[model samples]
Target: MVPQRKLLKVFKKTTYLTTFLLLCIAWSRLRLFFLNVKSQPNAVEYNGGLIDDIKLMKCYRWYKNCETLYAQSAVHDNSFVLWNRVSKNMTDSSLYAIESNWLYETFFYVHLFNTNANKEDEKQPLADIAVSRDPSLVPLTVLQEVMPSLRSSDSMMGNKRLYYQKTSWWYRFWNNPLPTKMNLMNKWKHNNDILWSKIQHDSCLITNIQLYLGSNFVESRPFWKEIIHELHNEDGNSIPISITRKVECGFDANHTFPKNTINNKDLLQLKQKSDLKILQLSDIHIKGNEENSAILGEFQSRIFISRIIDIERPDLVVITGDILDGNKSVDYQTCILNVVQPIIRAQIPFVISFGAKDFSKYATQQEITDFVNQIPYCLNKNSDSNGHLTIPYNFSTIPNDSKDDYSNLITQNDLAIFIFNSKTSKRQFFKDYISLYKSPPKLALAFQYLPIPTYRLSGVFPIIGQYNERNLLPEGFDNDDNLINYMHEMNIKALSCGFDHSNDCCLQSIHDIWLCYSGATGLTAPHSIFMPPSVRLFKVDNIDKSITSWKRNYNKIDEVYDYQYIYNQPKQKHTPSN
Candidate 1:
């Protein structure tokens, strides 16, 4: 009886141990499965042509067989209509089989031969295959009409046609493609006319091909490569199909600067001069769309900016904020490219201080920073820099006088240009800037999107220029005095902001710092008054130890207003405008 009882106790202990181990294993496996699902990318990596080639061959064979059948049929009806009728009668046996007229048309476009279709010696087809996964249909007939002109101008390949496919949930879950690439490819087709105008001067072609199951952003992928084509599934979703050719091009494929590097001839010229001219273009709310009005407005804005750059010929350009109407823009990337084209063409060193609208459903702040930094002559600092810029200057001629030393003070570089993002942690960024250098440059100027509390106060403080609207402070900065104190402590002479479109004023704060506003430069943004679009210009003279600023209205007469000296000024009673 004692042996039997002991045996029962041992069995019970073994069963309990086994149960506990099994529970732990099950929990761990479940956790791992969830983690894997969470970590999986929206799109799969590009598989170089193994499966893609086989699929392409199958599609080609189906297309040839269909063409033969259509030619044999004596029906004189529209090819598109007849193809539909025939497809309805045919049995769907394979994945590549043309089961609908849309598929037949897609296949026809994809296999479209050049003018030398009958020439047997011409082995390689003139047109390459483009597959789109987007639900929106490409205007194949319109594109066909435009293709010859594009080919004649060398803007596109001879007669490329896009194929379509329907996407499946299982395929998307396992093999989705990068969204950025897909978006770009879709943009190329949808905004072909706009894209052609933008890239007509550059030679572009497809150098590499990739196949993806679904579309999603390349969060972990680097931005060095550019998308040349997109693959589409039957449901109208799209994936990145090809990479930009490795030739000299004007767009994203080729960038002059590496990450966080600043190389601009105009910036380098600052070392040799005592005076620097800076152009502040604010609120050029460009909405990249297909509308004629939108296109014309964007074009006019570019011309206006170009004319201003040519007229002012400033040493640097500072776009205050709201470069694009992010909410309204069809393509944020295209809008960004359009916004910066003038500055890039002028070869002027520029920095951007993004606004509230800059961060929208279309793009994040980091993505904008990354995209802008890639453009040539752009001095936009990396995310880590907290939007700080110091123009490099020669230190050999440091002024000996303590008073002049402040003016001539050069830390890592010569003049300090601090650009703050209103949406970011302003106080923290200020703290970080202060911590970086023991003392600030005497004539340092700051740029941001939203105005501080000091700008809104009336009475006692001397104000210049037009204050047509109320001031809007950045979030959590209404009662915060640390930023103003930091600017004062750093001896930052002036701070320029651009959120209030109607308020274009320079007010002397109690801290002796100049708080200025750059009026709206965009034609599309709202305006309380019947004033023309305008940009503020700042000229900093090291020899005179002064900074002069004024607004130039975009009109036939080039009207100028609110001219004021920022430094060494006397207190005045009333606001002035010209």
Candidate 2:
């Protein structure tokens, strides 16, 4: 009778307790969200510190992490925190999580905002805006500044708590463990860490951050504010003093050689000691898509070589790969041997390697053996021809045409070019026509046919044979080994091969095994369909055993393969005749 008199009051008390628990959960979530936001701000930065599309993607991912964390804490546990003004009122953890998720979606729009900001930065007359408006760059950089708001409190929610939770006994029936804020926080942390690293390295980010904050993001913004105010006061004019122009002043150092250019004294001194000039051409897929004008452009291989020979007058030419998109038996002889080999003939001590496209997918061990036997001219006039193996032009006159004496064809260096032959995924289709005849009709994967892998795989494996990561070269091939003992090898200081086109080239090791790639002739063949075509000139002073790269890029389309090397420099400056 006494309980019945106050049933409503008892029910209200129980409900209040439940609501209080939920308030605690929401608060916990808020703490977790703050920690995540605080830890990941650097990840959203690009260039090594922050500023790029990848960074934006990373920010969006972090925001998504915040949503997932909320959903997990609410759905997984009956016990959770709440958003309370003065610790009296309570809110449901589930509803709070849902609201937090709404914030997540709202932040996703922030991503779009950042992307648009970047796009607008690209489209707008940044220079004019920077000069005309005192705070033109600040509005665009607002997003970077705004990110810190998410990290207001870190301790109550503690940064580490953003990542996980133990499953309640009631929730243990399901296969998956209870979701925690840490899932997204951990991922965001990883991504942001990468973004931070990248942004730290980026010059644009550095300069911009310097412009905005002066030294740090927060400090730089205030510094820029003062700078803008000062810049506007210079002449009492609306237009501010322009630092934007200064930013772009030294953007391209390569083309803008100084009138009183001081060459690197050591490099210049080395050049004086020995004339080591090299011609490097890479990623030249000859038989790619017909519309892919890169190959057609490179068809002017003869013209470029002629120009380079005239200009550089170098001793050697090194070709990396895609010698002619030879994925099949038909393409090797027709495109590569016919198109590129003629141009290579102009240089002495020409070294080359096999790109992936040169191998046969259907080739058995015997077929591979035969393929290697015809190594000198893997795909030449003699390939699928009347009984005669193809010979290099310089040594075509040598009688008794056998594989052993094939190296005798070249006049210089007393060294034989060991062309690597590696197969690709499309090799099966190339080796046999049946795969193409199937119902699905195996067409080439548009991206895979570029032969870039074949070029690199073929080029590198031989250099670093079946060796462990640290120990390069296969058994018996290492220095002071059985092969060295048997062959009495002398003066083989460098092993150079090319393919894997990149103008920003590198040497994997010292001269013992030099990994060199002669940038592509057709910039449009693979992923570089948008970039300008480029090439590298490698010069090696045989006496000094020194090598150097003269990287060059061409804006004009026709000028791509229209020049040659002379002493490791372009023979003629390709003036647009049109």
Candidate 3:
């Protein structure tokens, strides 16, 4: 009887526990179902059309005023306004009112046009509702469906706000004296009324609002731009700030590429002339505006280059690499612009021989090539792949008063100019091209970034300019003499390079081939203070059948120096001992 009672009790207890478990499960399922239904957006009915209603609602004012307020605050404070809402519980209501303008402007249209309203006849919420309520609680998915740009704006604005917050003084001045509540409210209301009036007057579709807001959000609330943001103090030095404007957006359409460009016809005309002057600029290590001081800004490099271009007025310009300090430059595009703008403005045809330091983790060689291609008057052929360019100017006949010594070598009075990327290992392309020619042209000049092995034998050979740094060859060519031997055999008259910043020497190697450096042409690069920035100039006189080279320094007093003949003057019979 006792065992039977115990078994009955156990069964009853088990039944009770099962019933409670089932009830809990059912309750949870019901709760989940209700939550899902709540999250789902309700169907909206448009009286005219969804687009027309949005246009009538003047929702675009929200976007325009939001962006306008953001820009104004950024300009006024010299920093990005914080996107997150300030705590209302704080003691300073005036401060809160002033600082919360961005948030109010950002969501004012959404609140006024509240598509989330349950019924078509339901009155829309006031614009200030978004400010009163916690912004995070708002349904982002619903907002996104109405205006896709809002999501992107929210994301970009928040990120920029946080980034600047960490570095800006505007965010740190919480304890500063605040305006009286009456004055703050009056100013706020006035600003709000102005924005409201503007919104009521403007009519735009939802798509237009999205487009305007999306495009201008990043532009208005930028964390970095071509112009560096800094605060001026009593000492005249500025305290650097983190906020900046959009560089691409700041680019003026009026800054078009120069119209002057060199073509086959132009080259032919130049060939007809007695001489062709070529300017070689190298090691222009532009590290962006921020990395440099006010005096040494990237703009200063452009100014210096512009001044030199005006003085030299060379027919052709060759930039021998290290055009950008990729690792240090905050903006590679701006850095590149600074370096090329001067040349582009001057409208001289130019080519680039990329150096090892021209690209870094931030900027790749392909990116640099693509950017350079956008500018006019640039003659870089295959700049992205191997940076190989071959320009052959074939004349109808040799000059009327030509020397007999050039009869064999100068078959057609053709002049050939080859630009190679020393950073590349593939020489087969040039080798094949050179093989096609039985003999070299009357004058052949090659431009590259790194000097050939012959340059290392500077002491052994007769050099014209200063030799300060040790010679360096590109990788994969350690103790390699193949390239040097090929150039010598091909009768390539001059090989100009620019990796060694301090070594601007033109060494007369065996077979009378000249290896020259363009020197460091930028202020930011590590160079001797004694040796100012300079460009190497090559004057190829077709009439003289000679190449004369010299250096033009930045100094106003003694600009030109190291004047020497590169080819067809006198042969130095010196050889490197094995």
Candidate 4:
């Protein structure tokens, strides 16, 4: 019989082919690993193209506060693309994505590398160190941006792959398909494509290519390298430069200024002519776990908030607190950064009020306040233990016919948004009176702190609908009989607070004064898939001195009973103190 070695050598081609294929697989995986590990150096650029889009967004934005309607470019600006950069760079959203993706891909890569490339497992989370990004302001940016597929539907399951078993029946039956589910999805995708036709009207927005394989466990890395290169370049336009619109909310532009207006043009101009869309995301109780492994809650919240910002493009965002779910000391920085960074990047002024769970986990109330003040766009600038946040809209005060900056004196609509630290989340005071009478239950959750009367909720929801039962404000603020009295004096029309994840809104006073209990923006973990999360929105009819609010429970919009709260100048609800 022929020697065993000689028998193996007889099939040299097969052996060489098998070896070649194994190397290819390892190489392909290595490339994928590198892709996710590195911050695409060119991601999230704020280039002139984007600045121009910002101009278009200003012009084509649903709320046309300015008279530049016709001037709204023959082309509509893409707000989605501009906002994408703001989200990716402003927060760790993209970085976390890259790191996570890299770790996943590297797992496979290193395994293959160990077997094929003669490398050993160092037990490293990733193969390489993370790259840094520029956070400073600059013009003409070139970025590698990450975005939810502009092509995706409003479906919560998220983006679908291109080639799937579910092909359109119209194509299968050889007929032109329009108005089909596939067709509608396609058109919705075209929405983003439509934005770029104006910007790059000269070139093809996308190109398609077919791929091939070499072995069952191996693939050609060269083809992948070319694809990745194209992907990196293709992303340049298909990403930060793309646009998508998926809003179910209504937009009202027909304006009838209040019947009696101040004669001052500057002041009248300050009255917002356009409908104000204020997006409220409350009770996103992100746990303060410092570990990178348990950040899905934070990620989900960031992604949802950012996506909603893109879709809603609201004039203001109100984040009713309870943003952190972990102990106040547990990686509060990460929770705070992930929570508020998007608003900061969008340059939208926002307000935050504390909730029962906000300080329940780890950080103290003061620590949370310090974190909030660090964000520039956070208008809650009170350093005391008092209970109020006053945020000014950074509106452009450019006069109708003059070009002068009145930055200091005026804000959008010359209106103010007030946030109250309604004492829903207690300051670790009175303990719960459970089965034990002053037994000091071993696992005590809430109890009133001596002299403060701040009721805390350790592991239970705060009892709502009980007025004045708990401390509604810090002790310092009790000097005022009722906070509404102060709101009346300040001409504050919108006051928002959160503690209850319930969607509760009411016209608590006359003349369009709104007292809103913004429902939880994100649900507590280990919840059922069907437990709908709630968020609040206010569409302000500035001329009417009134606002209409809607409660968004999951994807459904539930209008409150007294949703429309409009002010009539003649009918004063309550008298202000002298």
Candidate 5:
């Protein structure tokens, strides 16, 4: 990590092209200032080359296996299907994702940089430009300063000047220099090296999560080190997918709810017709028009998704936004078509919801709806009535084995499937809904952005300090109580969201509402959106009013491949409903 004031530290203006590779390597890591090699008993040490080598090996091995599969796919279909090339790109992106540097456009497009950028220009800090994809890798103090504090009581829509203060463009423009290892070494040049090492100490959770910033202010988690160590030892035959059970499953044992917490009662009594199977996919970012490679990468997702749909045989498919890369890519329509083309052809009743990404200056919310509606079976609508594309769930139509296609078994009655236009805060439906809907609409199940509060995130994956006070709910609501009250008032059963790529779920037990995350489904142009490709399956039991979720991995090879339960609270019906 080079200092912000020191521009062109490694490569001079004239010699930049000659030292292009060297420059990227320098940009990738802090080679100059890692002096104190602390002898911690169980610490996975990091260096510039070791990190890159281990990450690349994992990536290449994964991609190689996919190539073998691609070659085999030719046996099934001889045609050079445009979308068939998507998987290879997915693997390649994951490879670049681990190392973090190789994925940069600057690596290939050296021309993108202005070698002439001198001291006077005071251009954005390099680290600022390349906002590290994995926050776990950045220094804790930097993360503490930069990222938003998860507000527990703040409204969905509030006048949050402080929230944006640190993360604002002007703030970052002024002070975005992440302190690094060099900063530490320089401080103790004449002082005791042993004292500095003693101060920081040997903590696995602290040390490995960070890159070698010029200073040693940040710490990395033990989990990532374990991932790298496993890969380092492997023969590279089987590229290990970063999978397995969560570090801290369920809620933290230590933290208890306040005494004023609402009492639990079995309120969800369902006259369930039959179990409904829903397939959820999100952040399937496609940028084929940007590059031929992107086309291949996105198509791989299509094939993978199609296979999962065939196996799971979900009755409903819900793509919870970010279908297209948020850019002026001509491939937006093509990408959406590719993702749901099989489902469309199969006539599986599916709905595509909008996210903050879907509506940009380049593509409006209505345009996105219109694009998907082109597919006959896609139940996406754009209207002023009710809410935009709110597909009411029909409880009358049971999952009929009598029919050949069970997906069509669901007839629309009034199950809450609303596509909220986050862009249109002015819309009456959204304004009231955000404030608080007067009454619950049908059997409420929402598909929207802004995840259900991160109260215990720091405890699970240990962050810098005691409390990670961070909340991501959009502004306007009165407080956190407003959100909880809204759910209780509406009998909100479940919410499926997709802005964050990480797979995380938690049950907010006010009315037994489940906050389900359908992690990054596909890879695309921006590497920040890269996570191993996977989708989630939800089985909603109307009879008992119980909703259970299972994750289905695409490239990730895990022992558990079935629909595993994320939350399985089936409220036993003691008394029969009228």
Candidate 6:
């Protein structure tokens, strides 16, 4: 036999070559398929010129052929529909989606011939296309009669056709095409008055436009009554639906308390329900300054708490990190003592995790113990800080424990809260156990808003550093492979942290992991509340102790502040008419 090692080497080389040859053959086939599909008639042509009706009819015929070929060959069926139906004289609702994505390409060719190219050649075909559907040839009165259903359909509620048509706002759709490419291809379409106005006035043909525009952020009201009426007409089973609305229940405008006193004894009566009511007050960057003071002065004082207690009546509250101004000052603990401690005193259970500023210096067991002692409901303890505490902290520490008769609340219960200390640059130890457990009624992984480094924005600290006495990031901090590996090990669905000052948005994930930045609830000017200073409220429901319901309220405080900013007044003009 020829040596066995040499034989093995020959086999490995043959396998590599065979794989490379197969890849080349596949790539060649894909290129040939692409060419064959594009070679269809009018598939390559812009057809910008406007010939007489005789020639224009031919162009439309050719356009139809292209549409047929595109529909059959394109992998994305929607793309074919969008391009063909918006090509003029093709107004069939079923033929097009609410948003015709090809408006730009179609309009580009139409306009290119009209404005920049040879007039007789370009304008003839363009005019021919326009004239084919004109009242002069087809007659406006006749077209209306021909499409009578399209006119009266808007008034009908829940009509499938009407709903689909109204669902999209045509005016918005028309304006959305980018204006960057204003060359010959887009010139003629830009001046098409009849086509554009038809899009706006034929609103009835668009079903969901009313609903889309009638939303709180938009103009007009296609009220619930109308929606209900539509639902009844559409199907026997269609009934009015009501979803529980969550309001970020907090006070920011410094509303004066009533002279009548509300006792804490009476306040404790609200938490007696089995339903879990958790309030998230996140992204509060408290830098001790005038702006921060203004925020606290308006809502952080005793008046604020009194108002909140009277209004929201929450059972438990979670401060999802960021309780300091800057990482520079240790004064954050004092700020919390002043603001958060009083809220805790009112007998409302609240949980807090460290923000970016809190972990400038690592916490010791004593520091964690002292902080928790001051804020009794806080999950961290002296033992927890030392890494000696058991996996789940004692739920007995939760004040007003209703299920006190039952033992093993932490070990056996479905409502376990995990508060990961995200203040440090490196991953926390809690990450290790997250994957091992099942989803709970509430699984919260709290970290500071150390952004996943972007092209423009730098993260909280220098990147690519090893853990050292001065800088404490774990090994391979800057490596993408390491960061993702750490997150996977932690079994995080979605992480909630508070480092950013802009709007809270979500990330790439299956879980509703929201990257929430609640703005400065304290004195920090480096932050802006994107719109307003606010908190979020989640009404978490459990089915067999698994978290089933999570609803959020956005821009609650901002809505109040925005109204004041616009009207220069505190309240709106309307009260209930009755």
Best by TM-score: 1
lDDT for each candidate structure: 0.53, 0.31, 0.51, 0.37, 0.41, 0.33
Residue 40 in model 6: shift from native, Å? 98
lDDT of 1 by residue, 193-232 (tens): 1111111222232222322111121211212233323333
> For residues 1-578, what per-residue lDDT tens digits would candidate 3 score against the true structure?
99999999999999999999877745643553343234223322221111111111111222322211111121122332211121111122221122233223112121123344454442321111101012222223323433467765353222323211132353234211111111111111111211111111122212111111000011121112212123222233322212122111121222212222334234323334567788899998866543336225455566778887888888888898888676654445445555776676666677878776776454455666776764456676434356677655444543344322223344433567778877565366556555655556666788888887768783466888788988446565233467777676555788998888887888887777888988898877778777777789888776667788888876751368888887764446899899
The TM-scores, one per candidate, come to 0.56, 0.28, 0.53, 0.39, 0.42, 0.35
Candidate ordering by TM-score (highest first): 1, 3, 5, 4, 6, 2
State residue 458's C-alpha deviation in candidate 2, in Å: 22
**Model 6, position 157: C-alpha lDDT score:** 29
lDDT (0-100) at residue 512 of candidate 5? 52
Report the error of model 1 at residue 275, Å.
0.9
Tens digit of lDDT per residue, candidate 2, span 433-498? Answer: 222222221111011112221123324443321111121222211122222111113222223333
lDDT of 6 by residue, 1-578 (tens): 56888899999999999989877745543553353345366443222122111111101222334332222111111222112211212222211122223321122122221223353342222221211122113223223433455444332222233212221253245332311211122322212221211111111111111111101111111111121111111122321111110111121222111221223223322343444555556655543222445444424432443344445556766565556544433333334543564455555755566554543232343453364543344434422452221123222333364435332333333333444444333343444344333322233233333443321223343221111111233332232324444444444333444455444433333222333333334433244434334444443343222222222223342232211000011334687786
Cα lDDT over the full model 1: 0.53
37-130 in candidate 5: lDDT tens per residue?
1222332222111000001111122222211111111112222211111111121333312223332210000001123346344221111111
The parts of candidate 3 lying over 4 Å away from their true place are: 1-272, 292-297, 382-385, 394-413, 435-439, 471-479, 569-578
Candidate 5: deviation at residue 318, Å? 1.3
What candidate 6 gets wrong by more than 4 Å, as runs, is 1-273, 287-310, 327-333, 359-369, 386-412, 423-493, 508-519, 523-525, 543-578
Candidate topping lDDT: 1
- Say which prediction, candidate 1 or candidate 2, comes out ahead on TM-score: 1
Residue 237's lDDT within candidate 6 is: 30
